[model samples]
Target: MPETPKKLTIATRASRLALWQAEHVRDRLQELYPLCEVGLLTMTTRGDQILDRSLSKVGGKGLFVKELETALLDGRADLAVHSLKDVPVDLHSPFALSVVLERDDPRDAFVSNGYGSMDELPAGAVVGTSSLRREAQIRQRHPGLVVQPLRGNLDTRLGKLDRGDYAAIILAAAGLRRLGLEARIRGYLPVEQSLPAAGQGALGIEVLEARADMHAWLAPLADPATTACALAERAVSRVLGGSCQVPLAAYAQVQGGTLAVDALVAEPDGSVIIRARAAGPVADAAALGERVAQDLLAKGARPILDRLSMPDASA
Candidate 1:
């Protein structure tokens, strides 16, 4: 371990859920080094400020992270805690994903106002979600139901659903559990039914690459199983060149010493779906993801992916 710093600061978004995750990290760090101090620096990002359009239309991977990265670069914060799903695979130089905490429920939650489950919901009902992955699966399984784009902070999204704008909404089960709103979940979407987004339910610590001391301090917080699974899952996305615009899902599970990964690519309207799976020793997780991605491409996912072009990110 490197020499512990006397004090450290964490940068985070100001949403209720983001604050909770940051505070959790602060508490754990304090518990580990009783003498050291930890504090939070909360700020709103452009992602949080813009809610009128689809995030995939506005931007995706970096909107939630770039502001926090600036804070780290300017020395305003020692590190930032994030939902690993929001972190881009092609992180710029000098920034490293230093640690990933243990994962929570890595499944999508089905929440509705009056429905007990999917079967109980009437045909042609409206369902809301911020994720392309969720939307694609919902359309595939419930073609009669109307899918609408719903985006905002957790509370904001829930409020929209409550206003009857949607018959129900889909959210990550982990967020609901963290906010003590698990009671609102009518059901858990099975992994077989809805594969999770890569890095869906894990919290990651990002720090400057040169900060060896910070890396050492954060290393102890990493959950090896979650880390391996996330790496493999992310590998699939990396290979497929996925962004929010693409309806892609990748999930990995580790058993004993082996890692298995599943990946999906689908049309934006859910008109078609393509899938691939591969497994190998845990040590070859990234390679396993690559193999799966290759399989998907060879099996006709390339045309599906090519349709979801990266718009001028600068636009």
Candidate 2:
């Protein structure tokens, strides 16, 4: 192990859930090195400030982490914590996702005040979600229901549903469980019905790529199984050039020394979807993910992806 630092600071967004995630890292670090001091440096991100427009329209999910990255760049913090799902697969030079913590539920939660499940909602009922992946899946499964753009932190989203802006809302079960708000989830959407976004429900620690010592210090928190699964899922996203502008989903799981990956590309309106699946030895997880991506592309997903990437694309 590298020599322990005397103090460590984590950069995180100021949202309640962001703080919780950062604090979780801090607590873990403190437990790992009892003599070292741990603290948090919180700031508002553009992703949090710009709620008027969808993330796909404003700038994609990178809006959530650029400021945090800036903090690491300027030495304001040693590391950053994030929801792995929000971290782009093509994260560039100088920044690296050092490690992924153990995963949580990795399933979408269905929350509604009066309804027990999505099937209970009547026609024309509005369901709010900020994810194009979730919106596309909902539209495909419940064509009679209305899907709308929802923005803001977990609390704000729940408040919107409470105030009746939406008849229901979809969220990651992990976030609610982390914040001790699991009671709010009426039911969980199975992976078969709504495949998770890449790295969903997992927490990742980011550091400057050159910080070998920093990676060493944080190594204890890494979960081997989750890391393998996440790497495989991210590989699929990387090959597909995935972003919020595209309704894409990738999920992977490791079981009994094998890794299975599932990925898909869909029309934004959910009118068309192409899916692929592949499995291989855990050591070949990334290769399996690449194979799945190629399968999706070969099975008629290329045109759907091309149409969405057009300048004035509207589905």
Candidate 3:
């Protein structure tokens, strides 16, 4: 067995949800290595800053982890805990995602003070969300509702809704459940209506690529099923060059010996949505994801992707 770490510091974002994720990891680590002194080192990332613009308009989800990666490179943190959906598909050199813990509810939550579900919202009512994927789906399904940009931490977004900035807002069900705010979720958007982002509801630990010992220490925390699913989902994103710039969603599930993946690409205005699904043996999860991505491209996702990548698409 590898020697247990005597002391470890985890890098984390300072938001309530981010701290909750880090502390959950810390508590689990303590249980495994009772003698280890685990501490959390919280820092704000650019993702947590610049609340005025959407993440897609800025730099994508990499903004969330760049500072934490710097911490690992400089020896300030042994590992960083991240919401897996915030991790980019291609990690830069010298850094690696070491483990994926078990997943929570991988569904989108509908929250509203006046509405019981999205279907109950009146036409022209405002709906706020921080994700383009969710926005596109809403527009496709409910063209009468006004979809608006909502940028901020969980609490901040909720506050906006409470103050009448929106008639309703969409949030990750996992975050609400994790924060013990499950009652706030009036309903859940079915996967058929809104496919989740890759690795949604899961936590990933990032470590330096050379940290063999750290990998050893963290190995026990990984859930084999979740890891396989996350791999497949991320594979789809990687093949499609997915980022916040595009309204893309990939979700995977592992059951018995089979692993199934569902993915989609959409125009920002929700006018176009291309979807694909594939299933295979769990051992071939990544390949199954790639197959689905190719299927989507064949189904006309290529033009949507090409148009979005153009320099003036946002203009």
Candidate 4:
């Protein structure tokens, strides 16, 4: 008798962007292993159901990932597809990030119907975004613009703009491209103006650490440069013990075998901002991130960080 065919199950959130990412991974896996059957298992997360409270207040970035991870832990799924940024700084030991796909445009884009760019928006124009990092940056740069809390999936946010609820909104450029809505973006925010969230524009495939066969199968998809850069970005968050409640942002990129990392921390109200950068060999990505975080913390980021770390803040 012939041996049974192997089937791989990929778990992901049901959101359009999440499914797109899962499908991207599924196609790649199928291409590499012709005999393997790939299936997608979509699940909803706590973040998806709680639109009323800010992510930071509700439970930080982990809200979007915990449910999917649980599915993996329960043996219902072999792999979990996640937005790199949404993964927490610390992860459970049994699980490991097996592969990181090549990153997309790791910048935030300004999506607007009336304005050409953030600068062109009329004074007092309502700009929508759910990210505290973006909210703080917008406040610093365009103080005159009104920052409004907007939540829901990507399509829902854009629908609000179409319905005249907002003049503009900020969203990740990579997501817009994934959904084929890049044309709606009026301008892309440069890093100088808005440092991206840690691990932005990247996709992470996570699986059980003991699954050697699965790891070997997925290894080909891993991009070393992207992985190094993402690790460096996440390192800043980890070193600082940051969560969604803290207004923190970090982005790293590898150029000519050198990794450059930029990180920032701001007061919740956007009153104080501390920014720093570091460069080193790509192999020392995590160390470089720690160095940058230490520098920022030394430069009075500690006080601002203390306020954010208060226990009741997350509650």
lDDT of each: 0.91, 0.93, 0.94, 0.90
Write candidate 2's Cα lDDT for 29-145 as tens digits: 999999999999999999999998888888789999999999999999999999999898999999999999999999999999999999999999999999889988899999999
State the lDDT of candidate 3 residue by residue for 1-315, as single tens digits.
578889999999999999999999999999999999999999999999889988888888999999999999999999999999999899977999999999999999999999999999999999999999999999999999999999999999999999999999999999999999999999999999999999999999999989999999999999999999999999999999988889999999987899989999999889989889999999998899899999999999988888886766665
How many clashes (backbone N, Cα, C below 3 Å) per candidate? 0, 0, 0, 0
Q: Where's the lowest-lDDT run of ten residues in candidate 1? A: 306-315
Inter-residue clash pairs, candidate 4: none
Model 4 clashes, total count? 0
Better of 3 and 4 by lDDT: 3
Looking at model 2, the pairs that clash are: none
Most accurate candidate by lDDT: 3
Give per-residue CA lDDT, model 4, range 97-155, as digits (tens): 88889999999999998889999988989999888899899999888989988889999
Supply the TM-score for candidate 1. Answer: 0.98
Backbone clash pairs in model 3 (N, Cα, C under 3 Å; residues 3+ apart or in different chains), count: 0
Runs in model 2 deviating more than 4 A are: none
**Native-vs-model 2 lDDT?**
0.93
Candidate 1: Cα lDDT at 147: 90
TM-score of each: 0.98, 0.98, 0.99, 0.96
Quote the lDDT for 53 in model 2.
Answer: 85
Q: How displaced is residue 299 in candidate 3, in Å?
A: 1.2
lDDT: which is higher, 1 or 2? 2
